[model samples]
Target chain A: MRIRVATPSGHYRTPTYIQGKVGVIEAVHGAFRNPETLAYGGDGRPKQTLYLVRFDQTHIWAHAEPVPFCQNDRLLIDIYEHWLEPAPEE
Target chain B: MPGVHDRGGWPDVGPINKAEHELSFWEKRTDALLVLLSSADRRVIRVDELRRAIESLPPEAYETMGYYERWISAIETLLIEKNVLTKAEIDRKAEQIVEQRTIETTE
Candidate 1:
C-alpha cells in the first residue's frame, strides 16, 4: 500500500517522511475513529481501517544522506486506511 | 509552520534518544492525572482533544517543553477552554501549592 503524504493545507496524521512512499500492509487493525476529525473534537464516527504498514529503512531514507541498511531493517507505522491507496504495480 | 509535534522525517531531526529515565513523583502524578481526567467518570477531555491542544501550543513551547510538560500544558489549556478551571484559579492554586511546599520544608 502507498500512503498519500500530500500537502493537505491543514493538520494531518500521516507523517511526512513516509509521504509518497511505498510500503507493505503488514496487518489490518480494524476500524478506528478518525483522529483527523477527533483532533478537532468532532465525533470521528464511521471508523476507518487501521493498518500496520511496514516500510524498508532504505526506502524511507533513500533520498536523505546515504546511510547503512541491514537485512532486517524495517519500520512499522500505524496508519489509517484513508491515507493509503493501491501502489502502482512495479 | 508545521506542527512541531508533526515531526516525521526531517533531514535535521536529531537521533532518537533511547535513554530511559526513572520518573519522578510529580511526573508519575501528572501521568496519572491525564488518565484520571480522561477516564469515563471525568471525561474532562478526550485523547484527540489533548493531542490537538498539544499541537495548539506555540511551536517553541511544543519544541522546548519536555513530554510531561507538554501534557501539563495541554491539560491546562483544555481545562480552561472547557471552562472547568480558570487560568487565574490554576495560577492561584499553583502558588498555593508552592507556598505550602515552602512551609512544609521550613517545618
Candidate 2:
C-alpha cells in the first residue's frame, strides 16, 4: 500500500522528523478512528488517523521496533522511499 | 633550578565544593545520550557505548532522571512506529539482549 505522510493538524504525538516522507504500507494494522477526547476531556469529535509504515533505517532511527512501549506494540510511523520496494504485480 | 624556592607564600586555593557536581554529571550523561539518540542510525549504537553510558551514572541517578528514559523510549518508539522492526520481532530482540546481559553479568 502506497501512502503519503504529512504532519497531522491539531494535537498529535508523531515526531516532527518524519513530516514528509513516502512509505510503503507494511501492514494494515486495522482501522481505528477514535473521536473520544479522553486526554483533553472534551467532547470534540477529533479524527485520529493511524497507520503503520515501514521506514528507512538509514534516514531515521529512534523507535525502531525490536523494542516495546505501550499499545505502541503496533507503532504508527512514516517511512521513506529508500526502504520501500515496488509491490509485485498481482 | 630555583623554581622550588621561587614560589612566594602559598598559591591561593579555591573552594572545591562550589560546583554542582551531580547536575554536571547528569548534564554530561544526558548530552552523551542525546548524541547517541540523535543519530540517524541510533539502533546501530555499539553495545560498548550503551553500556558505558548506562554505567557512568550513579545508581540513584537513573530514578531521578526521567529524561534519560524518555529519550531512550522515544528512540524505540520511532523505530517501531516506523515499522523498522515489527512488534513481534522487537520483543524477541529485546528479550535476547536482556538474556545476553543477564548471562554476561552472572559470569
Candidate 3:
C-alpha cells in the first residue's frame, strides 16, 4: 500500500514525509477512531482500520542521501485506512 | 508545505536531546490536567483535539515553546474553543495571579 499524497488542511495523522511512500502491511492494529474527525470534536464513527506498515529505509530516503541499503534497515509506522491505497502495479 | 508540527525528516534540525530531567511543578500539573480532562469520566477533551490545537499553533510559537509549555497552551486553546472557558476570563485570572505574586514579592 502507498500512503496517500495529500496536503489537505485540518488535523491528520499521516506525516508529510510518509505521504506517497510505499510500504507493506506488517500487521493490522484493529479499527480505531479516526483522529482527523476526532480532532474537531466529532465522534469518530465507522472506525478506521489501522495497520503497521513497513518501508525499506533506502526506498523511503531514496530521494535524498544514497546511504547503502541494509536488509536490517526498515521504518515501521502505524497508518490508518483512509491514508492508504493499493500501490500501483509495478 | 507540511504543518510546523511535522518535522520528522527535516534536514537541518539540531541534534536530538536525549537528556532526561525532573518534571517541573507546573509541568506535572499540566500532565495531570490532561489525564483528568481526557479521562472517560470527564470526557471534556480528547487527545486528538490536543494534537490539533498544538499543530495549529503559529510557527514561531511552535518553535519557541518547550514540551509542557506547548501542551498547556494547546489545552488552553481547546478550553476556549469548546466554550469551557473564555479568553477574557483566562486573561483576567492570569492578571490576578500576577498581581498577587507582585504583592508577595513586595512584602
- Candidate 2, residue A5: the lDDT equals 43
Name the best candidate (by TM-score).
3
Q: Judged by lDDT relative to the true structure, which candidate is superior, 1 or 3? A: 3
TM-score of 2: 0.26
lDDT of 1 at B13: 64
Q: Which segments of candidate 3 are over 4 A away from where they belong?
A: A68-71
Model 3, range A1-90, lDDT digits (tens) per residue?
A: 999999758888888889999999999999998999999999997799999999988778888766567866999999999999999998
For candidate 2, lDDT tens digit of each residue in B8-101? 2224535455644354675567557657654668634333234334433454654355645644544454445456667788789889999999
Model 2 is docked with a DockQ of: 0.01
Task: Give model 2's TM-score for chain A to 2 decimal places.
Answer: 0.42
Docking quality category of candidate 3 according to DockQ thresholds: high
Q: Please write out the lDDT profile of model 2 over residues A1-90, one tens digit for every residue.
A: 333344343333334444443345775444333322322223333444455686554334344534233432333463333223454444
Off by over 4 Å in 1: A8-11, B13-19, B99-107
Q: What is the full ranking by TM-score, best candidate first?
A: 3, 1, 2
Better TM-score candidate (2, 3): 3
* TM-score of the first chain alone, every candidate: 0.90, 0.42, 0.91
Shift of residue B56 alpha carbon in model 1, Å: 2.4
lDDT string for model 3 (B19-77, tens) is 99999999999999999999999999999999999999998999999999999999999
